[model samples]
Target: MVADTGKTLHADTLKPVNLPEPIAVDEDSAGGPRVVTLGRKLPVAVIDDVWRIDDEWWRARALSRMYYAVILVNGRRLTIFKDLVDGKWYHQTY
Candidate 1:
C-alpha cells in the first residue's frame, strides 16, 4: 500500500552533475595547454591523449570541442577541453 501524496515534479527540478566550468589555460605555440589554473598555476607535464568531438552539426548549436588528457607536473591527471565554438577552456572529468 502507498500513501496519496499531492506533489508535482518538473524537469527543471533536476540538476546536472559534473558540468564543465570555465578555466584559465595558457597554451603553447602549437595550441596545446602549457599551464592551467585551478586554484594555483599548474604546469602541464605531458599530454597523455588528445581527441576532438564535432557532433550535432545539423542542430543550431553544434557541439565541437578539442579535448586533452594531461598529466600535471605534480603528477595529477586532468581532462580539459577547448570549446571550438566559443574559444574557451573548461576542465571536466571523463
Candidate 2:
C-alpha cells in the first residue's frame, strides 16, 4: 500500500536542496530510466505516477526533468527526478 503523505506545496518547500547524488540507474532499451539506486539499491516497487516539466528553457540554467512518484523496495515513498538537461538524478523530499 502507498503511504498517505499530505500534499502541501509551500513556497519554502521547493528550495534548491541540490546535493548532486550519483545514482546507478537501470534504463530500458528505449533509454528511459526504469530502476534507480538511492542508498540501498532498491528497485522501483511501484511507480505511482510520472510527469515532466520543462522550465526556463531559453535560459542557461534550464530546468527540464522527468519526475517520478515511486515506492521503493523498502516501502518508502519518494519523489525523485531525472534532470533531462544534464542527465542527473536527485532525491527530493518536502
Q: Candidate 1 lDDT, tens digit per residue, 2-46?
A: 886776778998898999989999999998999999899999999
TM-score per candidate, chains pooled = 0.87, 0.67
lDDT of 2 by residue, 1-94 (tens): 9987988899978877656555677766765556777655677788898899999989989889888888877888878878898887777666
Q: Model 2: clashing residue pairs?
A: none
Top lDDT model: 1
Q: Which 10-residue window in model 2 sums to the lowest lDDT?
A: 16-25
Error of 2 at 59 (Å): 0.9
Candidate 1: list runs displaced more than 4 Å.
1-9
C-alpha local distance difference test of each model: 0.95, 0.78
- State which candidate has the highest TM-score: 1
